[model samples]
Target: MTDSTPSLDLLLAGYVLNTLSQEEAALLEQYLAADPTLQERIDQLQATLEAAYATPEVKPPPQLRMAILAATEALPSQQTEALPSQQTEALPSQQTEALPSQQEAEPASWARRLPAWQLAFGLAAAIAIAWLGIDNYRLRLAKETAPTEIATETPASESLDYALQPVEADLTAAAQIELNPAELEGELTVAGLPPLPPEQVYVLWTILAPDAPFTADSKGAILTETFNTNAQGNVTESLVLPEAYQTLAQVAAIGITVESADAPQAHQGSPILLTDL
Candidate 1:
């Protein structure tokens, strides 16, 4: 039969979370198998759900798991009483006692229940909880594994000015710098560069030659007037020199310097950023 029902967001949510009945689930599965769009929607919903789960799991207190288990164990005894005969036979006395109170109080009601359906719902809930728990554990694990020195983009940009200005070394640690491939023929975008002091501004340098002690003056070529940042704090200018800088076999590295705004001078301030290009 053609599906005459309108697309239901809640139904889709139920399907992704595996809360649908077998018939409902089977219908959804069949529809998804035949419809690529529906399948994609389901995938997107699942990804979103997983991501949501990850956020909450990152710092779940130790008591959350115990609470979930406690709630699951508290399901109406009427709901769980009629466990399969085999389960009843195999269960220890302690285990039977620990079964939800509803199970004991409504044994007869449970005895008439269908094992498959009950098991399905139980399994679904268990799987959901497990997914949530594991996702949370993994998030916490990732946070723990991350290096402390790594600067995140959002946090670094909050208080900084984006105008053509000098930034301090303390602030540079939190500023991100971008390079357009078309504007600067270089690899690796340097993020989190701070501004220079009032009398000093930043100059981008290309080290075309590597001298013995590796002084900035020993570098063969200089990239000029190519540094710019926008209000949103993105680097819009090019620090790359002409094509000649690319041919030098011994180019040491790329370096940023603090210099007087209008003189043929080179004073080594704190290296704001550096990379081999």
Candidate 2:
């Protein structure tokens, strides 16, 4: 479609053989419109062909004619016997050379028939299946390890059931303590305590004699073991009276203290919450 010259070999063959298709002829005509070089080459080839055919034809000499005539007369008996013998002798050598080539070509021809894209797709699918299997295995291992982590890290005595109970200090600042006559067990609910620091907890204490508590050591006796507040700053726990004070219990109090997680010693930290029960 551009102004490039058409192929000279195609043009030469088509012109000599007179076998140009319609499209090829049109292309050659388009090139001739602008390509003077191609036109000159075509003209020169035509002139050379014409000059070759126009050259004189030479006649054979009389002796050469006599020699050809004698050879032609002897050819019939030679063809009847000699040609068959030569052909029979050449057949086995031809077959021997061709058999190995045919065998070698069979495997190569079948190799071309194999589907390259299908093999690539099967490999990709196998890789995807292996990756998914590994991912599922890791997920199952994480699921099995979660409960063990929770059991080891969480406190043993903390009540999971009363996790939502409100604290008593914020409920009533001066609530009176009422002794339970039937049994020496009671529940303590305290709320609005500030969130406990890390490795610190709150302990419930009983004031034995409010009028006689005068020293730091005799301020109050610990009633129940200490426990950490939940993240919501509420403490709810059960209290059991000490055997010595089972009948003589006067007042129960709740106090918040910062203490170590293991073998808590005493209320050594600042008290942020306090209430009489």
Candidate 3:
């Protein structure tokens, strides 16, 4: 509370609204005590504030009237519960005392139901704030996980899948590969094949015909791509098809050969895995 007239008016407004904390109220009280004119202004402001709240223009929810009545009915019972019988009896008589001057609550409401209306508003405000906080938190969580959800639901429609046919029999060591023909891209997934030596890389070849003459020194047949197997003889690898074949499925046969990686373009080893497109 300041000594100036404008500050006094603001202090009176806060006092009328019952919004001041104990420390602030104490400061205002001290200021008011020294000036009789300020005390008169406070009384006037309080009357105006009460009138404003009571007017038809300031309509509270109809439930608020019910809350006011309920609060008035429960006041005596709440006062009894505020001092538990067992706790009151346990406290030594000498320690019991009136509320100290500094700890004093605001003066009792002149209009008893006015405080009830104020209490109902406070409870409604607290509930609204809590609901808003929870809603914002949930929205934030959804935003953070949005990318992962979209990725999980997305279908890989651009890629074409080809099931490899084993040349000799229905072998379990064969790998399934998916290809995107437009990009000349391939992903080979190998499982159950015995892991070969690191020096021998697995080479995939695309041949022009089933019985086509082929060799490292030969022309026409091309080595599509090469990769190594993992510790479990399982490997999933991405490969690019040769420029001669935009789609590897266009070729007659696909074969995997255990060969030295030093000669990527040549086939110097016997075929270990053979399949048709």
Top candidate (lDDT) = 3
Among residues 3 or more apart in sequence or in different chains, the pairs in candidate 2 whose N, CA or C atoms overlap within 3 Å are 167-190, 167-191, 168-189, 168-190, 168-191, 177-277
Name the lDDT value of residue 209 in candidate 1: 58
Model 1 alpha-carbon miss at residue 212, Å? 13
Q: Which lDDT values do the candidates have, in the order given?
A: 0.50, 0.48, 0.61
Model 1 bad stretches (over 4 Å) = 1-191, 196-198, 211-221, 224-234, 264-267
Summarize candidate 3's per-residue lDDT along 1-277 as a digit string, tens digits.
2456544554565677776656657767877778767877778766554544443333345665566566557655554454345765677776545433432332222222245455455445434444444555677899999988876654332575665545545556777777665577878888877777767788787666544444323634577778887777788888886543453434666677778767666677766676565
Better of 1 and 2 by lDDT: 1
How do all models score by TM-score? 0.27, 0.29, 0.36
Stretches of model 2 off by over 4 angstroms after superposition: 1-181, 210-220, 248-254
For model 1 the TM-score comes to 0.27
What is the full ranking by TM-score, best candidate first?
Answer: 3, 2, 1
Candidate number of the best TM-score: 3
| Candidate with more favorable, higher TM-score: 1 or 3 | 3
Tens-digit per-residue lDDT, 184-250, candidate 2:
5556665555656766565655544564333324355553557665666566666674443343434
**Could you tell me how far off, in angstroms, the CA of residue 130 lies in candidate 1 after the best superposition?**
75
